[model samples]
Target chain A: MFLFFLSSGMFLGWSLGANDASNVFGTAVGSRMLRFRTAAILCCVFVILGSVISGAGATHTLGKLGAVNAVAGAFVVAFSAAMSVYLMTLARYPVSTSQAIVGAIIGWNLFSGSPTDSNALSKIIITWIVCPILSGIIAVISYKVVSVFILKRKIHMFRLDEMTRYGLVLMGAFGAFALGANNIANVVGVFLPVSPFGYIELFGDFCVSPAQQLFFLGSLAISVGVITYSKRVMDTVGSGIFKLSPVMALVAVWAHSVVLFLFASQRLEQLLLDLGLPTLPLVPVSSSQAIVGAVVGMGLLKGRHNIRWRTVGGIAGSWVTTPIFACLISFICLFILQNVFQQTVYLP
Target chain B: MAFISIFKNRTGIESEIDSFLNLASESGLIFMQGIDAYLLNNLDSFSEHLSHIVETEKEADTLRRSIEDLLYRKTLIPESRGDVLELIERMDALLGRFKGVMFRIEIERPNINSQFHTGLKSLSNCVIEAVESATLSLRSYFKDISQASDHIHKVAFWETEADKASTSLQKAIFNNNELGLDLKMQLRDLVRSIDKIADHAEDLADTLAIYVIKRSL
Candidate 1:
């Protein structure tokens, strides 16, 4: 039973890698700043680093979302979420693994009679709404600031040019690192609860003990996903929406990272919410959404005419529909899998 | 008496020709470096420099063609002959783009609406670094190519930076409304072309580095 959950987590991690890694470096590749090979290699390295170093908080949130004691339930949720993301990716739609997983967990909770944590759900929903919008706004402002102040001066053209070039490289590198740090949990957080990391394991008799091991496996799976399946989606996302200039790409990425960090910061989210402001919890919202919002925001700052409404509409439609569709499919799958497998598959 | 005087004058003139050749060779390096600086700083003023460089490069091309003809007549060049010819051709093409990019900069100059100045500058600097490295490598007279490799890496670093700047610049451009839509599109295209110059330079540097490394190995 434990093995089933662990395997399901690995599949979820693979699907996450396939979908999310594209978000991290797609712009760079799309803009031809980095080659596909280079981006893939970088994604692999930084994602693993992100998973190992900064993946803990999200893992805990996922583990506590619902009861994981019923191994079959955990497996069903994991499998459903993975399949949803996979099918979406196959259809060339940029769906959010974070959203799918949360929805799946919610579906399971509904059937299990576990009271839904409205607070958690609200926070998650708020993040989903705000992250992209905020990221877009920040990208616009940052671009305006940098262009107006620093790039205009003509003091030693060669020296200034050199400085600007170096600065951009550093910025991209930082963005990549932040992406890894903030997103690792979304890929592998589910397995943290069932695994035995504490001195006395929570699921003592369960086969996979230590949540950290699950994270490690999850990270490995993500790496594999990044290497094998990320390119197709990366190519699609990188080139689909709009043609990006190097600076715009940087701004978009920077904005996405900043928003991810903001949501990922529990302390910050609480402070904002405490101030009577609508705040999003550190739920992993779609990086794709955050980037598109940032890109569009930057465009709006340019003017409404510059915004590609058609592309934006398409993306919005996907965001609105993907999770619900995934949930329904997973719910149906769960029913079917149970009926077919009968006693072989235990449903809690 | 007239024949003897003409003969003597011709001999004196022949002796002075070497000094002129030597002067031309020394001044050629200065001219190339000046062209690099002009392209890097005053990209908006590209046409003027491009014409001059194009004329000079044509002269070099003629000289190279003549040399090739002579080498072919003399018998096939030795073992390194193929490489030498290829190198010379590449060097000429590199100079040609310097001319072409300058012309392009001029053509795109009117659209320079201040938004892309930073990205343009960074890209120009990357080219300058690459050219400077190539110049240094050629003139060092020593066989050490590490110096050249170090400089090429710097160029690559700058190209990466240029890419970042362009992304931001484009974003800003997209946000700006004062510029007409046509002008904006033109500016975007121009910036892309300029960025490609750095990319080309980086390619050159990478190739040179590989050659140097392989030779060392």
Candidate 2:
């Protein structure tokens, strides 16, 4: 029964991997620079590291988004988010897992009569839009800088090719680590209220917290998804609307990882506070959108001939609909999971 | 010694350029064979040699196009791309000039005085030397750029000799009273056509020298 309940979070994890994981190495693999096997191996290793070490920062902010309050409710909320993501994906929408999870949590707050924090909800929604634009801008700058600095050098084409491939592998590893640290909240934050695992001592000295244990499990599901299902998404993203040159692909993914890290880094938030500066709001941003925006940014810089407008519109349309549909789905699924099945989904 | 990468065989530009270079060399060889077939008046061999040169020229063209597509798709060497492209185009012209001279000899069947035969053969040798030195300079440019200057000088010397020999051959054709006035002009045009082969090689050597200097800096 514990395994059965945990499967919903795993399903959400799988959805995250199937969609978000592609953003990390999609272009590298798609452009056939680094082989897919090398990409997957690097992604798995760094994702596990990021989840184990830095995954705690985003969970607190996600808790502020709205706590699920009960294990059964957590399962239903996660299931609903997973369902929304799965459905949107089948409809060929580039939906955000971050958005769906937040919407489901909001659905929980509404269903249980808890006061919804409109401020927190709005912050997340705004980030969903802002993160992509910021990445795109950064990409435009990176393209100009790299072109002026590196491409202008009288370098051999093969030397440049070799360097770019190595750069992608390194950048891809960083992107995976950032994705795990920032987005692990969506996978296991709901389960935090009813976490089952106790602290386990490892290496005889270090204590692995219950939260880390849950995150580890969640990351495992994400790895499974990466290993099994994300290949097609990688191929699509790699070969899609924007034809990326090596440098453009590198700039885009690196910019995305930087943005995700900036938003999700608790230490950076504290540093900003200490410096009396405005802290970047800690939120789970969409990896898919950040990468898409970066690609679009490169396309615009290359003169808009390559940007597939239909693809851009389809993804933008999904951003608005995904959350609304997830809210409805979670509201309905939680109600059924609670009343029809006679399950104690909520404290009330 | 050139800096080599293992990844180029898969789709590396260095390997592709190397193959292009190899094809360029083969076209030069077949150009000689076509001349020989024409000189011997072996029509059957001449047709085969003509067809072979045509086929090699087409393959070289196809290889050049493939390399250009890859370069545009990624533009790995944006700085030297124009120079590299110009070099390939110039090298390709050697075969083009060879084919043109062969076609003239086969179709016009000019009744050349035997004295001009030695001049044509010597001019052909000089054309071959110019092409060979130009190709060597190209290889040395990619391999050990500093040594490229010596090969460039050799290409320049051979090109000068070719220009001088072809001019003398034209003068000889015109001086012969037995040949028709129209025939003298046609043979002069033929010598000029062959002269263009060395001119293209000289052009490539000059471009390569400048390209290597830019790269070395």
Candidate 3:
């Protein structure tokens, strides 16, 4: 039973590598800034590190959200999420693993009396809506500030260019680290409760369980995703929206990272809402939407004419539709898998 | 004594290679610049220099090939060996294409018209800037990779600028009533070939930038 859950998590990790790993280094590869091999190495190392260090928050959310207590339940959620992502990749449609997992979690929850906290669900949903829009807005504002500085200071063109390129490489590194830390939860968070040894007893009964170990395993899965499957998506993201200048690329990455940090932090979430702002809780949002919003925002700083509406619309449409599509597909798949193989415990 | 012998022999070979590459860079730059001059002036002296430039380019190509073979033989690191060879081949190819354009100019000199000259010049200028940027980048290999950012930016900026320039030049050629149909057709083909030199240079710059970044040069 332990082996079943562990193996399922590994399989899901491999699928995530195939899907989401590309999000970290796709733009650099696509923009012809980094090669496939270099990007792969960077993605693999940093993603694993991110997962080990900061992957806990999202993993905790996923573990509790679908009531993935049993090994079988975790396996079902993993399998459903993996299938949805694989289908999306095959179709060459860029869909979010975060969205697919949410759908899968909901699909499984439906059978277990849907004990899902509406507040948690709402927070995740709001992140889906708000992350991209906020990122886009931030991207535009940042670009505008940078552009104004560039123009106003009348900085030497060569120096500006040099600074921009270095800044871009740095920003990309930060974004990659953030991605590893945050998204690893989605891959390995489900197996936490079933981990054999509960939380370790540090002082008294204060113990760390198999949850952390599972998170590490998930992080390893993401590292594999970076190594094996990330190049294609990196190429797509790097060159898909616009031919990014180094400055513009830096701005987009920084905006995306800021939004990611917001969702990943509990402290920041309360601080923003306390200021009379309608705030979205930190939920695992789509990195793709965040990046696209940043790119569009940067474009808008150049004016409406410069913004590639077609590309923006296409990305937006994918974000809006992918969850519903994934949910329907998984829900139907659950029914089929259950009826087709009656002896098999399809849903726990 | 053996160490001294080795040092003397090594230094002799190194200095010889240095002089050879220096000559190659100078001649390559001159040839590139001459291509620009020929397009702008359409002068007989520039055309004659273009012929000489082609001959020097052939010598540079031969030197580049020999160095590539030497680097491949001596380097212990398999990856770096391959990278160096690829870099030489690509850079040599840039010169080879410049020679090809010179050859075309030699052949088409008698029939070359003003529109041909205008479009070809703009395209040639783009190639010159790209090659010049690449050569400058090569000189600073030991410096921080960020040091080469200017070259990368120049390559990117000039490629876009060249595209805009070529579009206008082509428009001018097509819109002009003075040229004969045969000359117009020939000039259109010439413009495209010249434009490709810039495209190739951009590709070379991108490849080198990746190499620099990866190697932390």
Provide per-model DockQ scores.
0.02, 0.15, 0.04
lDDT of 2 by residue, A272-316 (tens): 999999988887778888888888888898779778888778778
True contacts kept of each: 0.00, 0.13, 0.00
CAPRI class assigned to model 2:
incorrect
Candidate 3 lDDT over A250-281, as tens digits, reads: 67777887887777777777888789776656
Point to the candidate with the largest lDDT. 2
Collision count for each candidate, in order: 16, 0, 10
Candidate 2 clash pair list: none
How well is each residue in A206-268 modelled by candidate 1, as lDDT tens digits? 453354455666778877877888877776556666656555666777787777777677888
| Best-to-worst TM-score order | 2, 3, 1
lDDT of 1 at B112: 62
| Two-way lDDT contest, 1 vs 2, winner | 2
Q: Show model 1 residue runs off by greater than 4 Å.
A: A1-4, A60-65, A154-187, A192-212, A267-282, A303-308, A343-348, B1-55, B58-217
lDDT for model 3, please: 0.65
Instruction: Name the lDDT value of residue A66 in candidate 2.
Output: 70
TM-score of each: 0.57, 0.71, 0.58
CAPRI tier of model 3: incorrect
